[model samples]
Target chain A: MAGEASSGTFLQGLERGLAVIRAFSAQAPSLTLSEVARDVGLTPATARRILLTLEQLGYVRTDGRQFSLTPRVLALGWAYLSSLDLGELAGPYMEELSAATRESCSIATLDLPDIVYVARVPTSRIMTVALGVGARLPAYPTSMGRVLLAGLSSSELDVYLANMQTEQLTPRTVTSASLLRAAVDQARADGYALVDQELELGLRSLAAPIYNSRGRVVAALNVSAHASRSTPESLCEEVLPHVLCAADHITTALKHRGHL
Target chain B: MAGEASSGTFLQGLERGLAVIRAFSAQAPSLTLSEVARDVGLTPATARRILLTLEQLGYVRTDGRQFSLTPRVLALGWAYLSSLDLGELAGPYMEELSAATRESCSIATLDLPDIVYVARVPTSRIMTVALGVGARLPAYPTSMGRVLLAGLSSSELDVYLANMQTEQLTPRTVTSASLLRAAVDQARADGYALVDQELELGLRSLAAPIYNSRGRVVAALNVSAHASRSTPESLCEEVLPHVLCAADHITTALKHRGHL
Candidate 1:
């Protein structure tokens, strides 16, 4: 895969404009012109120009002093999701799994050190951190992340490990590179991964890899529950079967639809 | 509200870059360099530069010959969705409505002549067209669209009517401008709208307006089903109450969360 943009062909203005868009977050929904400037490390005038361009494109809306993204911004993400077609293909199966397990179920893909949820079927709110589609969590500590990481080639895994921070999110989170590597290896060998409160206290999850027609793991499916409600053994025995079945169902559907 | 971008302040480069991004769709996931240029009305050189820039920013990925958006592109949409916080607040209620009605339920906001779905819960596949978050459908032919249009101010409604293209989506679709206005007025008077097979053959839906804490209609909630499965009277009697209740629930939740 091509790694870097050759400087002769890159557009720096486009990058800066996207950076300005990325500067807004849930915590900072509306930002002043100077706030956007500071967040993206650009001048107020430059930020204003980019924001104005976004506004013109119908992506951003300003309420006099503060600027916030409009619903039109969702179209950008929708293009990606609709192209993937994961939600349409896997949604029914996920709903069934969520109902069967009475726990939250999600499908995610690895984005380096983080796993981004592409589709989710929530049964109950169990996580301290709210989980939804497009929500990201650390890869090493999440069951879905570990399953995705296990799908990577050895060289790719090495590169990921080299840059991985392995921060201690919870006391049970494995921080050591060797141990995390072993866990990923185990996930590959066992065809599933089960993490007990690694990402947060009282949260346990089990995940399995979802393969495409090319026999490549394109995504990971998981069933997450409270630790008090599900022991690791119970999760492995009960939820694991349901999650693996749902993953296979999604894989088959994707392959049949030529989406794989 | 700031309606338009000031002419002299906008960055044309940013607008062109986003146009390049928007050019990709579900029907065309990957495009060659020349194809991207032709699709976006840009020169091959400019398209290559923008693609290279997007590649550097990790939003676009290349498979040697073809270029497709990477999962990172979801981040742009996620920023908006997370900021809106609509999916988290309204999700469970939508699910409940879908379960109670055994149909697909969604919440959408008016984007002028189109309605953009913000949150959805699907119980079954009822329409030939797949409906998901960010999916836009013409407002005049959809239940949610009528409710949202009815919520608009008279001036805004006039602006919409002036520019509206009333296409014949289905035989039942109201194409007459005056008739469409009557439908909008009826929606405003009844506090709900029931559309019968206007968007597609054998599809019916009912929608109700959702208010923010400020008592402004912020969104519309709807339940859709097959025409054979649900008649207009059945939809109004059985599904309308659940939809309206869900709308009220969402509005109350948004109010308590200070999202209004």
Candidate 2:
């Protein structure tokens, strides 16, 4: 897109190559040359060349006709994780909390209308959709998302709400902008958030803000469980204290390490 | 490097762009334009364009002059992790083993002479260097590395041995090729590998091979602890059984999913 605006400086080939890599997702883990070309808007011959180059670099592998990303591609994401040091700083606390709660604990940072999980420690499989590090969830329906959304400035939150596609992911999902805004305001006042069966049936999560050394809310930490396992009142009474404490511990650790 | 040989088919700009991203590391998390250009072996003008493109794509962030990757880059690795499904399949078992043994547990796959961690559940920080998913360690001195290396065919092992740079990471590290070969042979015969203070002075680890449905060794799972906390006999008697059991559970799960 930048290439269209400034063709002289931008490297469109680089953009196209990354798009090719991204075209392979959970829905389509592997694809043929033509599929890749069509998915990324490249010619078949160009896609073949890029695939060949990626294969040569060990980022991709080919089973003659189909191409898929290799484990080596994980290094691309590793570069960012290692630099962020989020896992290293927050992992032990999340692990302890998950162990204590017998549920999934995760850390996520705001990425506009979506919150992307950066680190997760799972105790059991609770949701139909498998959630892991880097999974994105809408800010309006999830506890972590709401806490992160609550951290944003009013104007930033307004802009996010203006462009947000408020779909009803589940019957409990808040589709009204005003209701969502009130939820976010409540999260800010409470210093934590609780979402019960909003993202999916039988799922509930509680989240608390994680602050950096500068006292800025940089991420949100959550504990998630099945609604059958945890009622909203129980989540607040049992899980909220642990989640808040773990979030505070991580914040303190980050501050001690001068990561803020 | 492949671009140098096959310039016609390779998108050198893509290669350069990735190199630029990889230029940021734990030691240098943030870089100026000139620093990035110098590290990636590109001109300032070219590096600026790539950085601008990445920034626009939300993969990189800039603070006036300095640039660093954003958490969105984790999605690139998530694509591979979610597709591989290794973490999802292996995580709960790793957590159980870690909890039972009170030691760190990890799963790693061989990548030439290095072993890349695919999944990890750590109980406590024992090593000087942080080891997480996607962290790479030389195969010669680590227990997981040895287990993975032992899984290779004789010819493949020979090729790896020939290319390996056998550095003396610690006083306990085996530097002789024949000695390392004997260690690999022992691992093959024992069905597990144990290394004490080899990779790091205070670290002890034991690893077992995890096989796919086809009975091919696909990965190695290990339990690690401080040498002060675990002796060789303790590792053999206490840690080995849990590590082997966890690996078997993961292998069986993989088989059930028909992933092998």
User: What's the TM-score of each model vs. the native?
Assistant: 0.88, 0.85
Task: Determine the iRMS, in angstroms, of model 1.
Answer: 8.0
Over B26-75, each residue of candidate 2 has an lDDT whose tens digit, in order, gives: 76778899999898887788789889989888888897788988877877
Those runs of model 2 whose alpha carbons end farther than 4 Å from true positions after fitting are A1-6, A92-104, A123-129, A213-215, A225-249, B1-6, B91-104, B123-129, B153-159, B185-191, B211-216, B225-260
Give one digit per residue, the lDDT tens place, for model 2 in A84-132. 7877778778878988888888888877768888777767432212665
Cα lDDT, model 2, residue B96 = 83
Name the best candidate (by DockQ): 1
Question: Which 10 consecutive residues of model 1 chain B have the lowest summed lDDT?
Answer: B1-10
Off by more than 4 A, model 1 = A1-8, A92-103, A124-129, A256-260, B1-8, B91-104, B123-129, B213-215, B225-231, B234-249, B252-260
Task: Give the Cα lDDT of each candidate.
Answer: 0.82, 0.82
* Native contacts kept, each candidate: 0.55, 0.45
Name the lDDT value of residue B236 in candidate 1.
83
